[model samples]
Target: MKYNNYYFKLKSYARNYNINPQTKKYYNLDFAYLVELSKLDMYIRKIILELSLDVEHYLKVRLLNDLSDNSKEDGYNIVGLFLQYHRNAGADIQSKADKYSFCSDLAEKHLDEYKEPKKLAVWNIVELLSFGNFMELYELYYQTYPSFNYSDYLKSIKFIRNAAAHNNCILSTLRKPNSLKKFSKTKKLANILGKIPEFRELENRDAMMRNPVIHDFVTLLFVYNDVMKVSATKNVRNKKMEEIRHLFCDEDGRIRKNKIYFEKNPYIKESYSFICSIIKYIDKKNKNPKHTNFLQ
Candidate 1:
């Protein structure tokens, strides 16, 4: 929560430029990379989510374990499977075994890290991105897992995931002048994405989810913890980050209104887009890899 002097200097520089807070600091390669790196971290989260589901399903369907049978051995088996998959990808098994062994050792070493119940299951992904955002999370992940890119969905989905993680309800700065209307025109996009059967359902649900979130914090927190939700909230909180950034990191980096500088900037929107896109991509490809599929 404590900020150094550079935060105030960044705030002043941003103010003198008279640009919107969101548009500032983005000019810096480090922070901008941080933004994208945030997405990459959520990309990592998305990857973990599928693994959790796959591992859990493998246990339940294949091993026929019920809800009451959740065990550490099962968790270890899941990690074992992950190591197996990576090994099959032409990875050196000795290297892989050593790696997972370290992870196992580390997971036990930091068992208390999960005692407080992080916003995400650490394994749940989408929720983890919400609190820590992509930039903060991904840096940790990359520092942790450097040789993994087992899925192609990592890049773009990570971008959207970071966007959602940070609450950028509007998605991007690259949108066209009539982007909302254009997206409205593509009401079928949701149907295509299975977000809704039609525009009516999509709009209705979006409105239902949006208003309450803008006005309610608990509801927002609830949905935040649930990755399988239908909330259309992404990029909504980018405005908050933008405002805080420019307000504090102005022309000379002088802190102003913000009492605390966000060290763990969470880009929830990026996480959203990430999980959504992954769900869509996996659905289409799981059955047939050749089918042409796209999401906006």
Candidate 2:
């Protein structure tokens, strides 16, 4: 591979990594460091994608079960109501379903056999919807059922989910502060982190959440811990969390690889420590069921 061509491409996406504004120099940037960063980003994206899928599956099962048990109406009727409440979104979902029916047997049924929303089952409607569309349905359900408000958290997860799914670089701006806007920390996340002694300090929590990537990644962990109830999935989460730990640190919680790279960037190191702390907190909670009830 040509170094200049790859450097130009990297600069196009990660301009902040090209130079340090404080010193007005190249900021110790090099192709080898850039390659390691890309490798780290790829691992992070895989972790996010796997965990987000777990959350999405759990959300679908939990929501559908709750609605079925509580609502007086049948599944088809409830789906119809959702469609009627959000007609444009419903139309768009149906259009996409029709366009891709050839690939999906469920979509084909939704189009050919159950032409109207009233004839389609709630689970089927949910199965056909994308993650973003599913969140819209979740919001609509929340308005009526009045459960724990996950709107803010869901939005953050959606942003990260889409980015990971699209193979975007998550750590391009690790050293740069977010200049777009101030991120509003979710109360539920704050409450959960507050229980852990390491994250009890306001400054610690604020510093971690200020970075957009860290914020979303932590939110994903929060949702996974709070909603994923099945024992099997919990086991999967534990295994995956351990894998993430191995990627950056060892059993003694020491940086394993790219030590100098993380040392030079305080924000990146802090973010890594913050994530490890949360994972450790969660692992402890998982051991003792008495402390596992986070949001309650």
Candidate 3:
């Protein structure tokens, strides 16, 4: 395989850390680990970008539905609550504002920018809000939706996101190459979480939790499926999984008969099956045709 995408992105990131000739020192360049990390970061960035867009869209609809008058003032006040909540939790509001300004400027024509706040759009509002704060707003404002522990889900999503964004070493298997200890522990934790009656029947629970990265992807799939088209989200997920498998795995690592060879890494197979299970569950349960129209 050419590995064009991973090759280019990793090379691009590598350019930033050039070693100075004057202060030459041994640089243990783990090319393989760096490639893997790059791949994980690429996939996670896509997932987070998609999820953020979907959540922002949903919030727009939810706000318009919940608030009788979604004017510039009403929208600003409601979104201010999210910013305040995040600020109260010790987040640097100034940094967030900078990001908001940058993304908003780039996406100015497409976004519904608020004149009063000068480049503040609905997307910008949600963009500045942390996942935890956004979840708080979701729970408090969106009363019609079934509320789970948003904080728990937010923690997992944000933790993995920050690790990838900051280029942290997140691959347990890569670090501890010879052992499957983390894999086993992941399975146990997944099974315990999946035991909830709501998803008790979720298949391949053990396999789904075999890898931490895969588990995070599953969390993303669940959220995307709920907020977007079930079929579309599932298809996007399957496509990404296929790309990852081809990029990172040998032919032996591929799934057959809904199973991966234990000797080969089963994380991809388990993760795919887990996502498929959630998609199936959603399809079965979402009987209301009206629910499919998320924009409405």
Candidate 4:
């Protein structure tokens, strides 16, 4: 109830234009659709923090690791900091479990059918990861929503989410979120020209997210944390991007790292670029809000 109230209050704040998280640059808005977007951002931040805690718990106890309770203090510092700063938290111990109950239930049913966890690979479980009654969600899901130019942006993020869910490195407190490419993937990525390169993309190898119907806290934490709320100028595309020189990255032939063989990973770089563009768009929104708070 507290978190729910808090979430709603934050939603109100955004709607009033009382708080614009952005710096002075540009993507600001006097009249903006803040409620849904703010809620979404808050939801994601909460998820990542929660998932980090889950990861620590799994590594210290569930995985049969040698570390003892005293020896390992949530090995990863990510949650430790989050827990320290944010007053908001899930109400109960099982709150995380409850949030993911749908996925777990589907996992159980599927696992029961197989009668063995070994048979259920991470890739095999995407159907189970559906949001609500996962089956219906899966039926309508599309890998590439081509209708939206930013479909590719969504695709890149989906890959990161899948990676966080499946990879052990992501789950362990011992591991860090430094390398975006390290996140697991369903299969080897196909090479697309300049848009995406193979070697640097998740190391250009196929991988699975993770198996087991039940997930540790870390999976949820990573998912929530990584899903950032973007407050960008609404409705800007590649064609419009050229007109605004300031918003674009000043690559200026300074050895475009993007050009280098990202043989190791492109997840972070790709995702970062997308996020920056969104931020720029937000500036545009701020500059030209449909309603002028101050008389024109």
lDDT of 4: 0.30
lDDT of all the models against the reference?
Answer: 0.30, 0.70, 0.46, 0.30
Q: Which scores greater on TM-score, model 1 or model 3?
A: 3
Model 1's alpha-carbon lDDT is: 0.30
> What TM-score does prediction 1 earn?
0.23
lDDT per residue as tens, model 1, 1-296: 04422343233222111233786543223333333433433333343343333322222232223212544333334333333333332122222323565333433333244332112232432221222232233333333344321122223233333434453422122111112332222233224434533324342334322322111221222122222211232233223223333432344322222213222222333223233333333333423534322322
How many pairs of residues collide in each model? 49, 0, 0, 25
Residue-level lDDT of model 2, residues 188-273, one tens digit each, is 77676777676787466776776777888888887787776467577776676666666655744334476676466555667777
Task: Name the best candidate (by TM-score).
Answer: 2
N/CA/C clash count, model 4: 25
Q: What's the alpha carbon RMSD for model 1? A: 16.9
Give the candidates in order of TM-score, highest first: 2, 3, 1, 4
Q: Give residue 118's error in model 1 in angstroms.
A: 24
Candidate 4, residues 138-238, lDDT tens digits: the string is 22222211121111222333333454444322211111233435433222212221123322344212211222101222223222222221233123322
TM-scores for every predicted model: 0.23, 0.84, 0.46, 0.21
Least lDDT summed over 10 consecutive residues: which range in candidate 3?
254-263
- After superposing candidate 1 on the true structure, give the runs of residues whose Cα lies further than 4 Å from its correct spot: 1-73, 87-157, 163-189, 192-198, 201-296
